[model samples]
Target: MPNNRSAAEISECIRCGTCCKKGGPSLHHEDTVLIEKGLILSKYLFTIREGEMSYDNVTGQLIPASSDIIKIKGRKGSLTCVFFNEPESACTIYDKRPLECRILECWDTREIERVYAKTRLTRKHLVSTIAGLWDLIDDHQARCSYEKINRLLKMLGGDNKDDALKEILEMIQYDTQIREMTVQKGGLDPDIVDFLFGRPIKETIGMYGFKLKKQGDAYRLITIPTGQNL
Candidate 1:
């Protein structure tokens, strides 16, 4: 059943703050200028890399990301957009907000949905030109990719469990080491690691219902019982 309603019929934003509170909007190629112009700093953003599990706002469920989803970072200890001033019910960057934010009409989401996943901006698009930096990001993506991690998880409980565990642990170790080294030696902002590498592998692996525990300088993967992920 199709209900006909023009976008113009939808009421304008009332500053309810629901959209900003839900989470920050994913950045698209069109929004790159905002970052280039320094209107949005790197520390204010993070990336959900390709194949990573991410919450889909429209579907209200976690789905594997199809590509890098660069997004504004949330305030500390909350998922609310950092740019959102809750007390004032206004976006600090309202005038220069991303495409999604400008097109989104909570009452009529048709326009936002049409361009939601197109022309997504990834770390490569933003940082690929920098010497030495892009190399590290590319290597990290290749070695610690969720694609490889998912494949390894499937091999667990099979005869290849031992081999799978070794590889998974190694990837997690590399992910951690590189982040620390990049922050210490590369002089990058500590918070920017999430943007460059898309969250620590050790942490995101929990999306598979597994976690790592350090045991005398070594790590062990443990299966979290159902309903215990909270």
Candidate 2:
């Protein structure tokens, strides 16, 4: 890749919205001004929980990532950036966009990757008023962490397999119930539940070699090969 480009070279971008089409930019601590000004609402953000797997742009590899990252939520069922205006091929909040969006250059990724490496804005920084919610998150996470769930699966074998599976299912259900109840009692938006509790039970459990199959209002566990890497 070219190390440098002139203004004319950078002006090659046609505003086709292809980059934003891929996904929304993750917010940095510097972008808190936009959030505080209501340009970026809490409802518009979601958390990427610690230990969740994601593609690292800097490393160009899929890695078990850490950090409770706050990212702009994408449109439902789509990867497109929430601020992207499809008809105009422009950003809806271009004037007050996240730092990543402002510095991104399709021609050279050095700037964006540098910003990406910095500490991200977390829920604690954005919603400090709701310290209780953070406490609830910690409680739920300790009880139903991926490490605990994975360990439970690893212990499965022999005649105790059925009993172990039942325990895993119950743990998942219990975790789901806590998340739902948190939203109901804490007055948090239902849309942000996944952010608080990490991904859905099925997806999180899938990281530990289990898949959920829905059957007539019930879920069945199916063990798939995961290399037991977790």
Candidate 3:
């Protein structure tokens, strides 16, 4: 919060408009339609890929479009969030922006400092939830998608999605197998569901490293693999 009257790291902003220019934000049905008509155009419109949506025949909801979290790019080996606009300077769709951008601000230098301080520990802790994101993060030499940034926001132990889910969503869609893992210490194996998706064997739930056997039981989850995680 050092800048007080200014944006967090605002001095660092070059007003490049990269966030709005190079990528697409998730479009609501109306936003999509407007764009198709060539009316929703902005000086910084992006090339977007839309996702699957369900129909509601009744109207109002129109259509729901999901975007790929945030678009990003590598600048001199540092990855920056694509929507990080520099001039006229703000989120193009601030009122309806997604949770991650919602969490960012033009203040909070302490936050920026904290993230850089324990990055290695945080990366090791969060690697499983994100899996392959490290390659992308490493490509930029910055860790932008870390979900643990919000770990302090956890209020209860059971079902919820705040900081953690926001962190996960920042990089990827929800994995279907989160429910199946048997977490002995509140941690699941590192992003193994894809190479070995579905419920893992019950006995293997808490242990990490190559799953030696195919889980015979349908309902039991198993531990598959894990890395030292940093």
Candidate 4:
């Protein structure tokens, strides 16, 4: 027998923990209540901003995100969801999981596919009403948008490469300074910075084959050699 088991025919969850280990689930509109109710915390989340390059597990490619993808943070140094209890092969938040987690079925994936990209929760959705902080986040997005970074990366290979590099360096410096300021001066939780501003440009720039070299208090952006640290 071919063991013709269709996804629809699979009715029970095996509690194998495959999905939780893969990575954290992205927040959806319905999941906002979890955050509002304090079941989930901002410190445990991060954002993939619009136009940022990220791996699409479904498409199996690195693609530019079309909109904000706010997701739970992974365990430090690993992609596994922070709330996953690996020893027990279970999710700590299983009963209060995000919409993506509730809908996900490793064998089928149809339910998750249909709702994954719809009604995603973003920074504005969560913090737009807050005084001062929203202004800072808005300013940060304008000054350090991935859209602008992509354009600058393209310019690096063009006639005005020097000017482009200078601008890129300035953006990187600003991004780093602001993050430090928020933690040191604004009394913000360091863990929540990723959720507020997306990942630091100095680190995320690596996706475009660039890395930073520090010389005293100043920083320089340089291209990585082929087949080297990506």
TM-score of 1: 0.94
Once superposed on the true structure, which residue ranges of model 3 sit more than 4 Å away at CA? 1-78, 105-230
By lDDT, rank the candidates, best first: 1, 4, 2, 3
| lDDT by residue (tens digit), candidate 2, 131-208 | 687787787777776667656787686567788788888888887887779778877788778667766766666665
Pull out the clashing pairs in model 2: none
Name the best candidate (by TM-score).
1
Q: Rate the local accuracy (lDDT) of all candidates.
A: 0.90, 0.76, 0.31, 0.88
lDDT of 1 by residue, 1-230 (tens): 13245546658777778789889999998999999999999999999999999999888889999999999999987889999998788899999999999999898889988899889999989999998999999999999888899999999979999999999999998999999999899898998999999988888888889999889988899998998762
Spell out the clash pairs found in candidate 1.
none
Candidate 1 overall Cα lDDT vs. reference? 0.90
Q: Using lDDT as the measure, which candidate wins?
A: 1
**Per-model TM values vs. the true structure:** 0.94, 0.80, 0.19, 0.93
Which residue pairs clash within candidate 4?
A: none
Runs in model 4 lying further than 4 Å from the true structure: 1-11
Reference-based lDDT, residue 185, model 2: 82
- lDDT by residue for model 3 over 1-230, one digit each (tens)? 12243344354534444434433333332233343454433222221111212122123242322322111222322333334444555654455443323322323434423332121111222233555544432332232211232231242233664544344333222222332332333254433332222222221212222122325632221234565211
True-vs-predicted CA distance for residue 211, candidate 3, Å: 30
Higher-lDDT candidate of 3 and 4: 4
RMSD of each: 4.5, 4.8, 18.6, 3.4
Cα lDDT of model 4 by residue, 94-169, tens digit: 8998898888878778888888778989899999999999999999999999999999989989999999999999
lDDT of 2 at 159: 69
C-alpha lDDT (0 to 100) for residue 114 of candidate 2: 77
- CA lDDT of 44 in candidate 2? 78
